[model samples]
Target: MAATGVSANRLELLQIADAVAREKNIEKEIVIEAIEEAIQKGAKSRYGAHHDIRAKIDPKTGELALTRHVTVVEDDWRPEDELEEFNDSALVRLKDASKRDPEAFVGKEYIEELPPFEFGRVQTQMARQVVMGKVREAERERQYEEFKDRVGEIVNGTVKRVEYGNVIVDLGRGEGIMRRDQSIPREIFNIGDRIRTYIYDVRPEAKGPQVMLSRAHPGFMAKLFAQEVPEVYDGVIEIRAAARDAGSRAKMAVLSNDSSIDPVGACVGMRGSRVQAVVAELQGEKIDIIQWNNDEPTFIVNALAPAEVSKVVLDEEADRVEVVVPDEQLSLAIGRRGQNVRLASQLTGWQIDIITESQDSERRQKEFAERTQLFQDALDVDEVIAQLLVTEGFATVEDLAYVEAYEISDIEGFDEETAEELQARARDFLDRQAAEQDAKRKELGVEDGVLEVPGVTLPMAVALGEGGVKTVEDLADLATDEVRGGFEVRNGERVRVPGVLESFNLSQEDAEMLILQARVAAGWIDASELPQPEPEEAYEEGFEGEDYMAEAEQLFEGSSDAGAEAADDASDASGEEADDASAEDR
Candidate 1:
């Protein structure tokens, strides 16, 4: 049997091991091992023994024990060899000699009672520290594993502390960080505030587990809607798009697959009960719910809700929309500070320009007036004739000359017979005017004659006019290939200048003129094909040199100072009469 009776009280060591295991929640076996190692170390440090020692606690009765193993030394062994030999030394000494023990076994177990041990305060404190550190490490690992996969979930927490614009929330299992940017603006959070936030992210950090929470996240709004609106959760309604000026206003488009279910009405609930709940959660931020649309113009019109749209002109090339509204609805459509239209633009992915009814009418009128003025100045038309043309829906000289008599008769006042007569007289006048203009052209040695063609299109005319090509001479000067290509070539791969003609919905002649104008503007043709301006015949023919020369000679023969003196005398007489009249009245 091993000699264990002399070791420290076995019961006390067992008690300590049991206590540590329970306190640290560690396995009893682990505590038993730790106790044994500690006892072994303490024995070696204090006993000065160069022998193998083992320590153990009795599992059943809480008893502890230790044993020592030593070498056998012969009586005749040297002192050094006697102590050094682990098994046997021939010339060494043994502490106890028994001649009766004839088997001569030497380095073996010796039974001796070791003294009882007492732990100093320092050792007890050291043991306590070791157990605590191990426990803490285990706890941290447990926590990290618990919260690693819960991001995007909504969690309820109590506000613990506010520090430097950050709020620390106390979740039951672990703490979460609510950063300043994640909190709703203007929201006041004090200690003990019960708040729910979305788990924005879960990341491992140096201190422990990191759980990031956010109240301002877009998903938070979606989650709130999901909770309050049964249709959203049940998949009957879908949020098509959302745009927010966070903390103030937000716009969302909702659609319903079930034709009977009104998505907006469902989300709003009865008298706005559902939406109000979401608003309260969002710190009273205003939300606008608009009906989602599949049609682009209709969708955009709905997106800018509360503002009625009379017409929406979509410019596909620019990805823009021109919205026309009545004058009274313009301000409402644009909204205060243009917030409605701006958010609508963002929602619809189109640049929107809102124009009122009156503004558009005024702009059209001004454009017509400008075109009339330019035509009148170029044609040298009499004012009365120009007014008549304008009243008869032929504002410009080009319109009067190029439009059919039947078209003029269709105007309010004129019948077909009157229009025909008017057309004949105008034609006769134009013929005479053209002769005079041709005579002047001959005088200048310019053979290119300006004449009007009713068949030419407006696009063709504008194309020619912008190019500074006036008559058929200008048109003939352009290369045929260049003229044909101008009508077909696209500018910037998307915008065909000629494509604008179709958008006008103009007549065939107007369409041709549009193309012609574009070609002329591109410098593919000359203006000589277009109508030419009349000659300066009236100025030349109306002048009588004889009368003007007679008047000039008379002025030269008269006294120029006599006229000046007469005007001076007349002014003095008027002043004297005014003074006499004032005296008579007095």
Candidate 2:
């Protein structure tokens, strides 16, 4: 066929397609498809907008074909609405269509050949726009596909621009953004500067594919260490956990698979070469490389290095630990602005409370006295017997009543007969205590519906009743933090105020379950309709230069008082009625 007036040579079309595909980093087929669509659009404008125009290009020969499709239908079957959708030039009746082609039938489509028209300036511009838009879309798809799996990997880029603390990076293939908060604190970048960052996320957006880079993320530090240390790269040393205060300090726990290789020494390298390389890249951030241990206490002790730990008490139910350090090492263990203990907690996945040896001793003595008094009052035992029970680690009447007779008998100065008598008294006292609490619960007018909620113990109900949360609706109206344990401002410092369930010594999981049940009972939602709470992101530790010596002194002085205050808060939450019964029983 002869070339049309506006048609390019077949070789030119093939060359343009190849050049555009390479420039856009997209498949050649995608570019050719876009070219075909643009030609089809131009053809429709030339022939008639209402006519169905299609175009195709041969991959091998670059031959172009343009055709106008005419649908054949019965004259009577053409509804007015359907006829309005087409022009007379686009549709043909079966009988009339068969005149042009001897065997045309209803439901058949006939292709009509037409000479290509010359392209006008407006049509050429429109075709250019269509090709550019399609190419852009294809480029974006290619960018997303290329970088999606690259998330969590480190990439090197040159700074393209810095806009309001956010750095735009030219990542060789595509552009990436390092948001202001994602960059290490106080770290600066200038245009054309070489920077390395972790590709934390890749999102396809309307404008283009968004690549998110981060330097402050803990994973970024881990990746840097893996890059610097050969043992880490080879899996001989594993990075168990890492916590950072970006641009200030970081803590990483490393475990060695081979017994001969020391994890911490390997990470540090010979003469501190490996860790120093990572530290320099992070803008002089101090890093602590510690050996990881399977035993939690040993791991925690290692995490809080440069300080001697006198004692470590684990509260498994609460997932908290109490670390008692020597008086001289208090400042070191707590670090500047509590950074050491906080990072240790994050690395170990536990809440840590650090106190000095003196504070721990004082707290222990006060606890001993309180337990002795509690046992004496609840079990109607003498001071001598109470002391013996306390010394045996029986802190409550429930503990005494639940233990085997032989276990209690093993206490110094206690025989099997005395143990049996103590057990009986303990059970009787508990029964009387429960009866009294039930009476108080009724007197406070706690709703029966609130009582029916699962996980709501009698003590929790009594506390809720006293707090004016009388019905399931009232309970459901409480916020999650309020139901769990809200915060309070004390001496201008905000601290958590133990909630109703916490006052009863219930676990957080139990409290959440109670709240969920209350929500269901209040007709607020079905059990299946509850939304899962999103996991909280780990916050980077912040460092401030504080007077650690003075702060440690203050913490030591208030350690026992804080324990007493918490106990008093718990007592008040359970109601004044229970306190009077205990006083009378004693």
Query: Which structure among the candidates has the greatest TM-score?
Result: 2
- Candidate 1: minimum summed lDDT over ten consecutive residues — where? 535-544
lDDT of each: 0.66, 0.83
Positional deviation of residue 415's Cα in model 2 after best superposition, in angstroms: 6.2
- Please give, for residues 467-552, the per-residue lDDT of candidate 1 as tens digits: 45566555545443334332444654643233222333445444455446545544566767654434233222322344433333
Cα lDDT of model 2 by residue, 336-387, tens digit: 9999998999999999999998998898899999999988887777888898
- Per-model root-mean-square deviation over C-alphas: 29.8, 14.3
Once model 1 is optimally superposed onto the true structure by TM-score, how far is the C-alpha of residue 299 displaced, in angstroms?
A: 1.3
**Model 2: worst 10 consecutive residues (lDDT sum):** 535-544
Quality of model 1 by C-alpha lDDT = 0.66
